[model samples]
Target: MSSAQWNAGQAHGEAQAKTEEWVKSAQNTANKACDKMADSRESAQHGKEQSAGFIQQGAIDGVKNTLGINEKK
Candidate 1:
């Protein structure tokens, strides 16, 4: 085979390898982003639950105080 033909084949092979490597890297990055989003969603849900509990407790305390249900003797 001629040198120019052999060189062209080698260049094509190298380009294909680089393209495969880039695709794998992009997939890895996308997976990581999805994992972080899931984690953030869980954290936000937990915070909402905690805030609801606190508000419920405060409402109960307000009702008791209004009725003088637990006034000090």
Candidate 2:
């Protein structure tokens, strides 16, 4: 094979390798970002549930107090 042809082939191979490497790196970054977002969503949902529970308990206590059913603590 001609030297020019060999050089072209080597350059193409190098370019392909770099492209594949970049794709893998990008996918890894995206996966990590997605996982982090999922974790945040779950944490937010849990916080909302806890806040709702507190609100419900407070409402119950308020009603009892209004009805003069306060339990001695």
Candidate 3:
């Protein structure tokens, strides 16, 4: 076999290995981004639930005050 042919084969193999490594790195980055987004969504949902509870309690309290129950208690 000629040296030129062997060199070309070696170069092609190296290029293929580099491409695989880049693909793996990109996949890891994408997975981490997805995980962060899920965590943020869950946290926001929990916060919304807490806010809604507080608003509902305030409305109940307002009704009790209007009915004079709050003063009686």
Candidate 4:
């Protein structure tokens, strides 16, 4: 092949390699973002469960106090 043809082929190969690398980098970033979102959702769900438990316990204590079961000796 001529030198000019060889140089053109090399340039095309380099461009393709760069494009593939960029795609992989973007995919990795998207995966990390998705993982973070899932983690945040799980944390929020756990917080909700804990808050509900606290509210339930407080209600029980309030009822007992109203019935004079919590009176001081």
Candidate 5:
């Protein structure tokens, strides 16, 4: 092959390699962001459940207190 043709092929190969590297890097970043979002969602759901439990308990206690059945603690 001529020197010019060989140089062009080399440049093409380098460009392809760089593009692939960029794609992988982008994929990794997106995956990390998605994982963070999922974690936040799970944490929010857990907090909601805890708050609901507290509310239910308060309602139960209110009923007992109104009936003069409050337990000694």
Candidate 6:
């Protein structure tokens, strides 16, 4: 209706748009960071599993050696 009222409405719309854009950007960044952290955790878990396997094998080998069993390899 009035020019001043129209300008105020436009400003409000622009501010809302800007706020929405910032929120989306922040969400995208957070999601990427969460994904990276999850990947790192998975890698660490795999490493831990491998280490445990190695320890178990070492224990088995130690028992065989103590019992004077000849190892093929």
Question: For each candidate, what is the lDDT?
Answer: 0.95, 0.97, 0.96, 0.96, 0.98, 0.96
Q: What is the C-alpha RMSD of each candidate to the true structure, in Å?
A: 1.9, 0.9, 1.7, 1.8, 1.3, 1.5
Alpha-carbon shift of residue 48 in model 1 (angstroms): 0.7
Q: Residue 36, candidate 6: how far off, in angstroms?
A: 1.0
TM-score of each: 0.88, 0.95, 0.90, 0.86, 0.89, 0.87
Number of backbone collisions per candidate = 0, 0, 0, 0, 0, 0
What does candidate 4's lDDT look like per residue over 13-69, in tens digits? Answer: 999999999999999999999999999999999999999999998898899889989
Model 3 sits at a Cα RMSD from the real structure of: 1.7
Instruction: Estimate, for each residue in 1-73, the C-alpha lDDT of model 5 and write its tens digit.
Output: 9999999999999999999999999999999999999999999999999999999999999999999999956
Worst 10 contiguous positions by lDDT, candidate 6: 64-73
- Please list all clashing residue pairs in model 5, or write none if there are none: none
Give the Cα-based TM-score of candidate 1 against the true structure: 0.88
Cα deviation at 13, candidate 2, in Å, is 0.3
Once model 1 is optimally superposed onto the true structure by TM-score, how far is the C-alpha of residue 44 displaced, in angstroms? 0.7
Rank by TM-score, descending? 2, 3, 5, 1, 6, 4
Clashes of 6: 0
Residue 67, candidate 4: how far off, in angstroms? 1.7
State the lDDT of candidate 6 residue by residue for 8-67, as single tens digits.
Answer: 999999999999999999999999999999999999999999999999999998999889
Supply the global lDDT for candidate 1: 0.95
Off by over 4 Å in 6: none
For residues 1-60, could you state the per-residue lDDT of candidate 1 as single tens digits? 999999999999999999999999999999999999999999999999999999998888
Off by over 4 Å in 4: 71-73
* Model 4 weakest 10-residue run by lDDT: 64-73
Per-residue lDDT of candidate 2, residues 43-71 (tens digit): 99999999999999999999999998979
User: Where in model 5 is the C-alpha error above 4 Å?
Assistant: none
